[model samples]
Target: MADKRDYYEILELGKNASEDEIKKAYRKLARQYHPDVNKAADAETKFKEVKEAYDVLSDSGKRATYDQYGHVDPNQGFGGGGAGDFSGGFGDIFDMFFGGGGGRRDPNAPQRGNDLQYTMTIEFKEAIFGKETEITIPRTESCDTCHGSGAKPGTKPETCSVCKGSGQQEVVQNTPFGRMVNRRACTNCSGSGRIIKDKCGTCHGAGKVKRQRKINVRIPAGVDEGAQIRLSGEGEAGQRGGPAGDLYIVIRVKSHEFFEREGDDIYCEVPLTFAQAALGDEIEIPTLTEKVKLKIPAGTQTGTYFRLKGKGVPRLRGYGQGDQHVKVTVVTPTNLTEDQKELLRQFAGVAGESTSEHHESIFEKMKRAFRGD
Candidate 1:
């Protein structure tokens, strides 16, 4: 096996990262390296690494084992006794619940359609304020001619001869211990328990046809990125006359040019000149909907955060809203004019860095005032 990187390092997280932190990091990394979204040459490799790390770290037991050993042999882990043993775990569980080798599936029974996932990218504002929009999706629909029966209008399906309408094929495997009997879906009948004698010309006996459909979707307000909404009976048609599957709309919110979000709270950095930092001023700042006036306090330091209550993104389901944090960054003058340079030098001489016999430090004076001393 190849030498594996630490799960924590792979996720770009510290060893003391919390579950929520791990999940958040994994999601961000997963989105960056997902093969469907990212087309970089190393994207697939990076995605696999992210997935493996999440798998180990997300589980407490696995995380404990990994933390102790640094490298746990996957094959030797609990329940990973052997490939064959683990493979049949689900089968054994099913047998335990429903009894072994009995209650065979009736292929003609109603089977729910396969669920479909559609990833949609929406604007950041649109995500904040829900929008009702139309979407065109191509999905499998029951054939009009055959009505999902997969047979001609006049002729019906015939019984499958291979499995005698049971829709299953039995396989006997001889192992060193004993005989392993397995029942698999019949290839001849395709698990339907029947075969169409005369196939429908429109669907060619598949019982379904691919067609484009228009659907209206209502996105609720305050939905964040990676949120999902399920639409019932919107996916591919089920086999025969069964119910249709659901369509899951996975959201991807487009990033705003100026804003970065954490939870419902939004953050933006505003640059301030030395004069603006020293002298209080009223500045216009952008919010999700409108521009608002932000009051800058005198002597504002770099990286000072001001919170505008109820000015951020709306809560997903609950009432009220989050706050917008404006981080003030003091920018130094880039170029100096002759007069401006001379004035600044004079100002610096007057406002010396340290307190002297003739001058008292402004910082110490402010501190004394705050302490009421």
Candidate 2:
């Protein structure tokens, strides 16, 4: 028990996390660590840890007990209540939802197909304006020849004589409390309750085939990175004529070379010459759509930000657009000619050491600071 990890920490949630938050975290982590999806060695272990945490936190009674005393003995209950009163653990809960424990399941029952996920990377501008494209995916589909029956064409499936079509077998176990009967899938029929004498050639008796499918996807305007788009009935083929599952597309937005976005606002830096910073000029600035003229004020300091309204990214929510911020950096003149140097020296002599109130320079401020003024 001392080596066990905290439930909240396992789910990456706080102690006061809501039920919805706990469930959401569980679903995300489960998908990330599912054995079918992730082939890593530790994926199954991580998935089990996530499932155990969710099992305890999902039940109110169990959650309260865990909150009070962390990681109690599995065979014992709180204050010696005994294991029988503990109400099933993770296996029981999983069985209840996935059709494994308690009652017998029909082998021919419809089971939903497994959901699928695809990650797509788009340009940063594409995220701002959005685009529509087609994607190819490999997925499983029901066999056309057997019509999802797993039997050969023109033939039908026969019921399993072992379990009497119940698809389950009863195992009686004697415990300290009493005798318990547990239901398990029939070994003869493999839980299908039907036997295929002549298997389908196309599907190899599996009742499904793999094929490449092309799907069209539409990305909405102003979609950010890590956003998801869902496509209904686009996952793997279901079993026993069940409905197909959905497909999830996760977005990955590529970085832009010129612009950096925060929320809807855009930021960029532009270089200005010393003459342009001192005498102010109308310079051309690049926007998302086209070039726009920006007026730099006289005596503008380096790192001064200028905002261009409605020049940033479009809003994903209600209305309008965001502003673009431009930071100007003054570039000093270099490799000056003798004539230009003499002219600057004469201009500096006339300017003297005095600094103007409205047009203060960083050098003047530093000098005044050194003099303790």
Identify the candidate with maximal TM-score: 2
- Candidate 1 yields a Cα-based lDDT of 0.80
Give the runs in model 2 whose Cα sits over 4 Å from its true position.
1-104, 174-178, 351-373
* Candidate 1, poorest ten consecutive residues by summed lDDT: 78-87
Clashes of 1: 0
Worst 10 residues of 2 by lDDT: 78-87
What lDDT tens digits, residue by residue, belong to model 1 across residues 230-252? 99999989886789999999999
TM-score of each: 0.64, 0.67
lDDT of each: 0.80, 0.81
Total backbone collisions for each predicted model: 0, 0
Residues 232-268 of candidate 2 have per-residue lDDT tens digits of 9999999999999899999999899889999889999
